[model samples]
Target: MQIRKAFRYKLMPKGEHIRKMKQFCGYARFIFNRALAYQKAQYESDNTVKFSYTRLANLLPEWKHEFE
Candidate 1:
């Protein structure tokens, strides 16, 4: 027999915290959109090209540096 315990806590974000959270969300959205667009473009150029997580993961640093 085994027993497990779990706890959940709600966030109480203040003004500054909310602002930072929004900024983080926006950055995440940007990264997702960029990745999707890259995949789309690659597919359009070569139909046989399948999605490659490793290739995209490798590009993350380049994307971050380019965007920043």
Candidate 2:
């Protein structure tokens, strides 16, 4: 026989932590949406577009520079 237990706890972030969290979340959203938009446009322009992790990874530096 085995027993399992689960516990849930809520986070109470400090002011600075909250601000940093928001900033990180915003940045992540921007990267995610931008990648999605690029992938979508490529697919729309050419139906044979294939997803490539290497290509996407290669775009990260450009995106970071553009974001800055």
Candidate 3:
């Protein structure tokens, strides 16, 4: 007998389910971006770009929870 080192996936979903999934995905993306913006505002405001390392590291865990 031989062993196989491969895997297959089946992501088949109903039409309605797909549509709903798209909507949820869009909403989730929007929320994620908005949260990032708000998080940035705490340290920067002018809407200009700047390095924000500490802020990002501090918020990483909270962001993960939001996604979960």
Alpha carbon lDDT of each predicted model: 0.94, 0.92, 0.75
What tens digits encode model 3's per-residue C-alpha lDDT throughout 1-68? 99879888999999999999999999778766866777677547665556466755676678669867
lDDT of 2 by residue, 1-68 (tens): 99999999999999999999999999889888988999999999999999898988899999878867
- Give the range of the ten consecutive residues with the poorest summed lDDT in model 1: 59-68
Model 1 accuracy (lDDT, Cα): 0.94
Clash count per candidate = 0, 0, 0
Task: Return the TM-score for candidate 1, rounded to 2 decimals.
Answer: 0.83
**Cα displacement (Å) at residue 42, model 2:** 0.7
Shift in Å, residue 12, candidate 2: 0.3
> What is the descending lDDT order?
1, 2, 3
By the TM-score metric, which is better: model 2 or model 3?
A: 2
Tens-digit per-residue lDDT, 1-68, candidate 1: 99999999999999999999999999999888989999999999999998988988999999878977
Runs of candidate 2 with Cα error greater than 4 angstroms are none
